[model samples]
Target: MQTGISYCFLLGWLLCSCSETKSNHNQSIQDTAAVLLQQDSTSVFTTTALVEDTTVRFDMSEVPSEPDTKIKILEIGNFHNNEVWKGADNKQWYGLFQTTTGYYVKKTIVQVKTVYDALLDTKYVWSGKQVSVSDKDTCLLLITGISLPERNIDTVVMSQKTIWPSEKISFTVDSITYTLRATGKRQKISNEVSDYRLYISIIKDGVEKQQLLVVHDVFDDTMTVVMWVGDLDGDYKPDAIIDVSNHYNNHRPALFLSGEASEKEIMKKVAEFSQLGC
Candidate 1:
């Protein structure tokens, strides 16, 4: 809720650079998890504890007081002379800055959570940053950012047209909880409105990128789900897998699209809930 932090000219350039230059536009950006680590005298990562669900942990105080690492904002543009300020809810703080292409300063709120790694079976807190995009003219813009851990790149950036379904939604195949909020509307295929939720999780492996998405549909009453494991990030080779559901109670098969090696694998049950019936 603070104002006059700096001149708005800087925001103008960020927009033009992303639009005017096609090559400059980063389309593969996705959501990921991050961890804010501080180097102690022992030169190791020691967790910075704060209040429960408090954004104060990420306060700019840590930014200026300690050695700041270059944390990337997936599915969003990089910041310029950005400063983190505490939100009205003193419990948290946000990264604020003027964009080169806009008249308003961007505000990014973030949180951290530790999740169990299925592969390693260990717990790791993933940083999640939410960015709200606004302009002087538009009082309410739908654009927001979610920063995932480096391993999980490719953040999602969408307007109100694509607010993901949070109910029954999840990031991983085994997740019992939903990560996004969804409307009850069904897609007719003709409509750009997607009732399904797409989750892309990536981890950096040397120079190559590993991308995986848990795209599923839970709108229908039937048991329908799709699991895709491939390079949805478009890195030339096809390294993904897709699974479509096959329902029992008179439901149709679903479609699960994945990989680029050849045919797009379609899940039988997934088709059951497809827009074909909607």
Candidate 2:
């Protein structure tokens, strides 16, 4: 009888210990859950606060004109994998680099009002030279900057617009009296190639200045086209001198003279004139 009683007591003690162990394990799980919930709540609140502050700051920064205005290019830099720009979507391209002013500056091949803002917290790698085509066809700019691995990426593509002016002039084919006039603001042509478009002023008596035939005979790809008003051949009258050379060649310096002078005098005087750099 004593042995049976001792066995019963031991079984009861074992059951009690197991129950306590299970309760302790459950409590530990609950404690961990509470800590995780608290951390999540704090994180959410902090993010919300940051978002609200950023919205307000953006509104405050709105102004008529940007304080630090710059020009943006549609296309810049060389391309990786030797792939060229396919000209699918005509977006301006820009390449940002650290400038001497501590702020980043960009050089664009396209003509734009200002440079696009540099990306924040993004590190651009200039491991290889990349080439980009400007959105504007008149200005073919080549930029040397960071390379992007993907195409049509919002972070890589620019939204800025590039404006280009025409470098082609309309001249008459007849050698009659006429007046030259500038139609609009002169636009910048590609600096890589020196070819500018200028309106000619033809002043003829008893002749409709607009009706006279003006033919443009000098359009050079390698020469710099320049215009000046001066007197030629000891004549006190003002004559137009369009120097068609880059001051390097000595033979047949192309000249365009518009006045009452004969074609022979235009050729002789211009050939004798010295060359000047553009």
Candidate 3:
């Protein structure tokens, strides 16, 4: 009877030990699954945070999708009656002209398209050569090619009177008065050649601001003349047309548009005028 009792006790002990081990294994598995689920949740949260940060850093609406449509104004002028000094090689060299009262200033308004076309225009070619000069005497050695002629101003009526470099030219655009004045300082190019530059000032609401307008460099004997300033596009804006000529020859007119219209709009107007052969 004792032996049978001992056998029953051993069997019960084995069964209890097996059950406890199985319970511990199931608890371990549950803990591992919980840890994996927490890691996955953390990964998803981190990804979401990164996306939100990127969205906050960049705003798509702030970037422009189109080209610049603002109006661009370019002024053209000439430097004339420049004195030529002979070099040691007996070749004539041009001296930098330094006079505010003897040059010409012209303003031209063009669109981005016109500028592109002008850059690609093959009619006018610019070439220059450097002349050898002695160290004692400073002279300009580079000489550019002639200015290309425009058909529109070839027969247009020009001013018979001479416009001095110091003359203050004024025009009204959109009821705002703009005055152009030449500073008379020589615009130096590499300390050899120089041209005349003009300043455009406007008074709006009793505030005045001066802007620089660069014109052509005048190397030949020429005269400054104001061609015309009026409305050309019926946009109620005053358009200024100026030119530099030599004894009724080599007439070059520069057209300027000053108004509320954008550069793109001005380019369209120029294109239309070109189609009309004007």
TM-score of each: 0.17, 0.21, 0.31
Best by lDDT: 3
lDDT of 1 by residue, 79-168 (tens): 211212123122222232323332222344443222222332213332222333322333211112222112222222222323334443
Candidate 3 lDDT, tens digit per residue, 210-267? 6554354563445545555544434454444455433234544444444433533321
Give the per-residue lDDT of model 2 (tens digit) for 1-278: 99999999999999999999999999999999999999999999988784322221111121122112122122233222112222312333443332233222233443222122232111221222233333332222222222222221111111221111243232332343322332223325643322333344343455333321122333333433333232321233333333434334321122332344463232222211221221
Candidate 3 stretches greater than 4 Å from native: 1-163, 171-174, 185-194, 244-249, 259-278
Give candidate 2's TM-score: 0.21
CA lDDT, candidate 3, residue 8 = 100
List the lowest-lDDT window of 10 residues for candidate 3: 269-278
Ranking by lDDT: 3, 2, 1
lDDT of each: 0.28, 0.33, 0.39
* True-structure lDDT of candidate 3: 0.39
State the TM-score for model 3.
0.31
Better candidate number, 1 or 2, judged by lDDT: 2
